[model samples]
Target chain A: MPEPERDILGGYAGDLLSWVMGRASSGDVWVTIMSNLNIVAVASLADPACILLAEGVELDDGVRERAEVQGVNVLRSGKNVFRLCAEIASLI
Target chain B: MADSVNFHFDIDGDNFTSAGEASVMIKKLLRQMEFSPDVIRRVSVAMYEGEINMVIHANGGTADVNVFCDRIEIVLKDNGPGIADVRLAMQEGYSTAPDNIRSLGFGAGMGLPNMKRYTDDMRIESEVGRGTTIYMTVNV
Candidate 1:
């Protein structure tokens, strides 16, 4: 978990990489169901606080390794995107 | 050219997993060189978009980053099916990427626009069959 204590200022939920790349703010908690290697690349460029993988999505070993190498914090939730966003909103 | 430091990478066309490696490297390099966070973000975002475009549209391409005292310049050259319409491609929500790429979370037509949005200047040179070359500069 890189920057474990970093404040989450906002949230963005998108499956489209380009859309997320353009709009996801630096400190936003990015929520998405897309699990791929490219997600790490996007996270690194966007510098999101963390990536919240909704819908109980799991990362493959290769992607997990990449995320670790890139120092991107990733979390998983069985709950859907809406609930995650709601929870994130309530907390931050 | 005399004072600029240049970095070059040959993007691999066949591997979707490796597409943005160059941009990532450049981002780290810029950070190490102590460029402002905003400048680093802008250059990396623009370069990342261009790298993805090359992988998606062209088979592969070459990316060149030149770091100078006042600005950073990026040149992307690809020998693939050229853009049919530069103006149309520049419009948001206008993408030619196939459904497979879209399924992977790209091809929404925001790549070119985002690149233009993050860079100070951008120019595109493409031919119907030969290739496409894009030049972009970000002010320091």
Candidate 2:
């Protein structure tokens, strides 16, 4: 069988939350613009490989602290949500 | 494992941020038990949706989970104003939640549908003026 896709970026907090909870595999990356602390909770529940905050948004201090405790890899992009998604799509 | 385990939690309806706490804890329990990832995910999503519903519609509720060898059963009971139309409520895009709820990134009418989607078996018992009970099972 062919290998499962890796590093594919999925966007939208709600849809991404659903997909991460349901469809996303263990190593897939999630890209979204939502900066709330709940994003960390969703990541913990979904067990995504990593999370990318797009649209040049910075993580809240609480979110960053929790991410450190949870060991969730988080990255930020200077681009917009749409542009980041497109770039992630190209990688896949 | 030959023994069955039971877990119970009180969901706080007033706090949206804490809605999914029970589900999150249950996920950890299942993982510690070495349940399959797929099974764990299904249970997590189903229970999370139920928890969210209880917080959003009902003024919170009680969640009971029974973990068996072959299946995991989740029961959510709420005393909130019961669902008027189970059929309409079951629809994918139908929502009675207010605008305030939508601002919180929920109220998209996907809660019930998502709960059903993630479970192997689901049953909803509701009385218009009384309350509602949701029973969902995910096979291990």
Candidate 3:
């Protein structure tokens, strides 16, 4: 959690990496169900506030390790994408 | 060109996990050079998409980044397989990538368009059976 206090301005939920990359804004809490190494790549490129893995999706050891090494803050939630987005919308 | 700084990298197509290494490296270098955050993000994101295209479409390729005072230029060259129709490939939702790639969260056919979207200028040179070369420039 390099920027643990990084401000969260909005939320974006999508699984299509390219769509997320093109639309996700900086400081946005990006929600997705995709758990692959490419998620880290997109997160890095898009500079999202943090990656919130929805629907209980978990990162593999390799991806988790890479995410940590890349300084990408990732959080896992058992809630589905809609529910998580709702919670994020309420909070931010 | 005399004052420009050039960096080169080889893309490893066999490993999907390592695909964006070059873009990440260049992003770090640009940060060290203190380029504007917007410029850094645009350059890195554009290069990352190009790298993924090479890894997913072409077997792999070479990437060169030339940083000048006024702009940053990225040149990606791949020899695996060239794009048949440049126009079609540039479409937002058009993709020729197999199902496995989509499962990995890519192949949404957004690579080329995103590259063009983020960069100031882009040009594609491809020969169907030979290879593809993409040139992109982002103004500083």
Candidate 4:
């Protein structure tokens, strides 16, 4: 499935979805190790450019399908959380 | 829209995986109804927080959304351990959610505050052992 291309504005790192929803600006590339389906909801609500899953975290069960159906861009990183954040910062 | 449209959903609180289904459905509905992006985003985000709250605190609940010409009204009701202090719960950075919930990426205590920020009107009615009903409205 294809999602609308989003421009990367910046990056936000947080494990708490509610906090990220409150503070992360629209188009920010959200970075987190949390891999729950609820992340799709927060990303949809916040309108982030995409979600970066660090520390080799991957969602389970039907989550990937939900993310695709909801059209939330999710990128996974094999690197640890700190390294992923650093890489995202360099890009932004 | 001339006549009001009502959308009701049963939020499943037994599992964390399906928490935001109601909000997602509403977002699609509002979009198909040709609501502006701003209105749709505000309504959905506020209700999304309320939905998540229902699952986290109430174990399960019902969400009723009324879409009228002038505003969108969301009534979130849950039968669970009711809020002890509405004021304290409304405060930013104050939370009663256990550490386990926090590890799941919610329970940051910004739920109600964020809901209030996005909607034009909000009211909360909760009883200690009975239930909680929250009404939120965003003007079109």
Candidate 5:
């Protein structure tokens, strides 16, 4: 059996919205610096496979709660948004 | 075209984070109703853009979605300070949204153009001080 293709990468909240809506397939991971509940809204809109908060950013409690409810996998990274995006892109 | 359903939602302008809720629900409903992916995507994107606009500009509004066999119609009405220049507002990359909104990752001025791009048809009715109403349609 063949393994599924991976398209892991980091993105800016603004730039990622449209790409996620039109191009990002399900199961793709998204990294961003945004920390508001609107991040969750965009995530739900994009339906990304998972989300990673980079640049040492912290999400509000409300955002975490909602993401949990929606069954979206959330992660935090010590790296900056750009670094994380680069690392993920290398892996992919 | 014979069978049709209507869905209505009150967009809460107070909470920018909750702006796209209606679009999400509509997307799910369309999926359950077995709409084609293209149709679902187009409708959802267009409605989401409109919802965001309502929150960003209107302080909130009402959304009415009429789903028909052949097409889906979405009407977004808001009672906020209306657009002073429809032509300028329609121009891509032109935005009057405050700087704070752009910081939150929206107000790129792409909302209306993207809405128009995804939908089959669109119309805007507005009075500068009164409010604005937008109608969009997607073929199913």
Candidate 6:
């Protein structure tokens, strides 16, 4: 759980991976409960600074592997997506 | 690079979740080839949108990317239902996608326009009930 070295400027919240893919911006933190391989892909394609997995959802090995290989930073939270997003916004 | 390198991918239309795989792969290859971040992002977004379109409209398709020193070329071909009105289809907000597609955050009708916006050159050929082929190039 290394803190993301890349600085995040803002955040986006969505569960549908494609929706996140089309709108997430570079250097933005992505807020989602999606912990799938495509989430990793979408994060990579969107060039987001990091992906915050809300609600403490667990990522299976496949998704973990993809995130590691793709260099997508995944952070976890016990809070809901809305508050998590707001906190991320304050951090940047 | 001394010679052109080509990357080919099979876009599985049945799997909406896997649509961006090819674009992600190409992004890696482009980065390895030392393309700038801006060019890579443009090509990746344009190609991702095209790949998603293939899966959404066609059953599946083929994406071929050729990388050269000065530019990258992408050609996508599918045997799915051809667009009835290419002009209308290319409009930024006109989408023929069903309601289900919108729930997935796609079928926004921005695919073709986004493709054109990112690429330096674009040509689309289609025949009703036949198929469609899109050719696009991004300069380095």
Best by DockQ: 1
Query: Candidate 5: where is the Cα deviation over 4 Å?
Result: A1-27
lDDT of 5 at A11: 42
Model 1 clash number? 0
lDDT of 1 by residue, B14-131 (tens): 9999889999999999999999989999999999999999999999899999999899999999999999899999999999999999999999899999999999999999998999
Residue-wise C-alpha lDDT for candidate 5, range B11-79, written one tens digit per residue? 999988778999989988998999987788788888888898889889999999999989999999999
TM-score of chain A for the candidates in order shown: 0.95, 0.72, 0.95, 0.90, 0.71, 0.88
Cα error, residue B93 of model 5, in Å, equals: 2.0
Please list the residue runs of candidate 2 whose C-alpha ends up more than 4 Å from where it truly belongs after superposition: A1-26, B1-3
Question: What tens digits encode model 4's per-residue C-alpha lDDT throughout B31-128?
Answer: 99999988988898899999988888899899999999999999999999999999999999888888878888788899999999999999999999
> Rank by DockQ, descending?
1, 3, 4, 5, 6, 2
Name the lDDT value of residue A75 in candidate 4.
87
Q: Put down candidate 2 lDDT per residue, A1-92, tens digits, no spaces.
A: 02223344444333334444545555667777767766666676676767777778788888788777756778888887677766777776
Point to the candidate with the largest lDDT: 1
TM-score pick, better of 1 and 2: 1
Who is ahead in lDDT, 4 or 5? Answer: 4
Show pairs that collide, candidate 1: none
Please state the interface RMSD for every predicted structure, separated by commas.
0.5, 2.6, 0.9, 1.1, 2.4, 3.3
Clashing pairs in 5: none
lDDT, candidate 5, at B70: 92
Model 4, A4-90: lDDT tens digits are: 578888878888887887788788888888887789888887878888888888667576887888899888888887888787788
Ranking by TM-score: 3, 1, 4, 2, 5, 6
Per-prediction DockQ: 0.89, 0.33, 0.80, 0.73, 0.40, 0.36
